[model samples]
Target: MTSMIQELTVSHNPFDMTPTMNYSNTTDSSFTNNSSTITNNQSYDGVDDFLLPWWQQTVFFLALIAILIIASGGNLIVIWIVLAHKRMRTVTNYFLVNLAIADFLISVLNMPFTFLFLLYQNWWFGTFFCKFSCFISPCTISVSVLTFMAIAIDRYMAILYPLRPRIPRRHVIAAIAVIWIISIALSLPNLIFFTTVEQSGVTLCTYTWSLDKDLAYNYLLLILNYIFPLLTLTITYSRVGIELWGSQAIGEETSVQHDRVKSKRKVVKMMIVVVIIFAVCWLPMHLYFLLSNHHPAVTKLDYIQQIYIVFFLMAMSNSMYNPIIYCWMNSRFREGFIRVFCWCPCRPCKKFRSKLRFRRTLFPTSVNAMSEKYSERNGSLMHTMTEYVDPDVNGPRRVSNNRNIVRKSDDYL
Candidate 1:
């Protein structure tokens, strides 16, 4: 009788309604048949039928749990190593410390909820957690991404302009502060826009902004998360590769070819691998979100389901991969990991002894031997000159004359 019921009847599947309907005024057989037809055409919610099993949930959560263990433990170690080791306290390392902090926060905040959300298949967390969790997710991600970009830019500056003054400590601190400020600003939208809803008796937490708003948010998210960062990382790393490889090809005599140089070159290669992985792992998800801006019709059931699964898996996978990247590709991170896990035996005492040993061994007996040789040669030349002059200019050479000269010098003093 009404447009709402008419639209609902047209949109939903038939044969899902209850059998009893009190059409008390319908006496005509045609009206009774129309009432029966309308009753048969009603449909109830179908989300319960579509719910996935626990194991069928995002595989990314399992991966995220594993990474959480490692990242929590690994990042703590990095923080300790960077703080304890004076060598790691440079301006660049300060940025690294912030990056580690960001990673740690992500693991602490994002990974556990991810596992729980996947297990439940719907938001079991209350309204507070739903909004808080969603809000923190974007913040953590933004911090991580922006930190990586900052590190890339720092590396580029270090390589491209080595002679320039080191980035000031104050500036590094200021940059980190700015990053947090911007990250919070980006995440602010989630707190405002995300909501929990009860649709057909199933309560769910989702970003329920309309198509236009979601598109704008998605486009901004993609730009912040992927496009600009990917572009900067790609170009900077490309230039770094060219610069380092070009140096390797220069005249060997002019260069200090050593294992240390080779090790740094290897580090550059590893950084490139990290950048590539960052791009490859995250690009598709961003592209999907970006294309979602078009608000394509989801009339096909399969397409909607597939999109949901793909994005869910993509997000889960993204959260789990960062620590693996750090461990697999970064030697500094590996070393910090070892120290963090207390793998080095008696590290503090060993470090002290190592410094003492280095100080003792730095200069050897060869240096003293050269000094002795020079002294002997100078004394012999003086003796030969004295021998040549004494017989012609003086009366005779005598031991008593040398004793008399010493006595005269003592009396004068």
Candidate 2:
């Protein structure tokens, strides 16, 4: 999740607006016609002026297309896993699935046109697609980030206080709906401020905002992209760390506590790593934009300013990397991944199936099959390893034995 992603290439103007020079003779003695009526044409050649050298624009768009394809494919796999596996379904993972869905839509919507725009720096898809695509990209990114924040909070609670009741499925659905509604609300600015303008006979997709709205736009982006969400992460993780590690009872255990300690530590470490990666990838981009807004003079540092665009794109890509981390670092996810990939041996699969069948027969109808399966498998393991008896046993054998003992006591009396 924390690896260095490839950066976006530098953007250059696709159209040539440079002036052409015309040469003329100063004096001609033999010519009867007037010698000097030269017209200056400022108009640029459509084909010649926009003639892109072979290696630059086309190839770059192709690379973007490749990334888009990978992102779309990978997100689809995640969605499939979440949907097909009942074990993968949870209030938290439900949100994650929604996030992936949004991100997949964003990748599908933005990347193709992004390539088109890069190739010509023009909007041939008309004003509607341009506005729609622009709105969708940020909307998805917002959903992705906010969902991550929610997940972090969920994880913190799960780890720090495992005894508490989980957030319900209905609220999770409601929360995801609200997130989308808010994301769409934030995206409305694009619908209002984006337009297609004709310049030098070429249509360009660009932001069209009044000066007052530009400031508002920058402020809104800053808040939504960085400030508010970082605050959420900071507060949640801080409390989580305190509750996990600050308890005296856990710290005081000394004899045979290594396994519990290590397991606890692993969970904490993974969350910490996730938080750090999110911070590292996004903080710089937000700071760059925030500073740039405050001091327009910072634009004079062209190279430094260019770095911001690269970082922002990198941050966007971070949305997809969380699932990879979950799969790698979390044992439950690793098992799910193995099952999905069909890496488990046939023997294990058969045994697992037998266990499932046993659970279904034992539990009958009242309990959920999945919960019954989990309980049966674990209880079977414990039963195999240790001796246990039912406290409520009142079978005929026990009743007969009790009667015999009482009769013998009466005979002795």
- State the C-alpha lDDT per candidate: 0.49, 0.51
The best candidate by TM-score is 1
For model 2, what is the alpha-carbon lDDT of residue 382?
12
Q: Where is the poorest 10-residue window by lDDT in model 2?
A: 13-22
Question: How do the residues 1-413 of candidate 1 rate in per-residue lDDT, one tens digit apiece?
Answer: 53222111111101100111111223232231111122222332343434455565555456556667766766676667667755345555676678678667756765576445433335566677767767776687677778778777776776566445657778988999999999989888777766665544444555545635644665677677667878878888888767756654322321112332343455556556655665665655555443432332322233343344444444534444554555565554555554454655665422323210102112122433213221111122112111101111111111221222211000000
User: Which runs of model 1 end up more than 4 angstroms from their true locations?
Assistant: 1-46, 54-61, 114-121, 247-263, 291-314, 329-332, 339-413
Encode model 2's per-residue lDDT on 175-267: one tens digit a residue. 888889888888787767676666554566666665466456656766776678878888887786675566544233322123333444555
Clashes of each: 0, 0
What would the C-alpha RMSD of candidate 1 be, to one decimal place?
Answer: 18.6
Question: Residue 222 in model 2: shift from native, Å?
Answer: 1.1
Top model number, lDDT: 2
lDDT of 2: 0.51
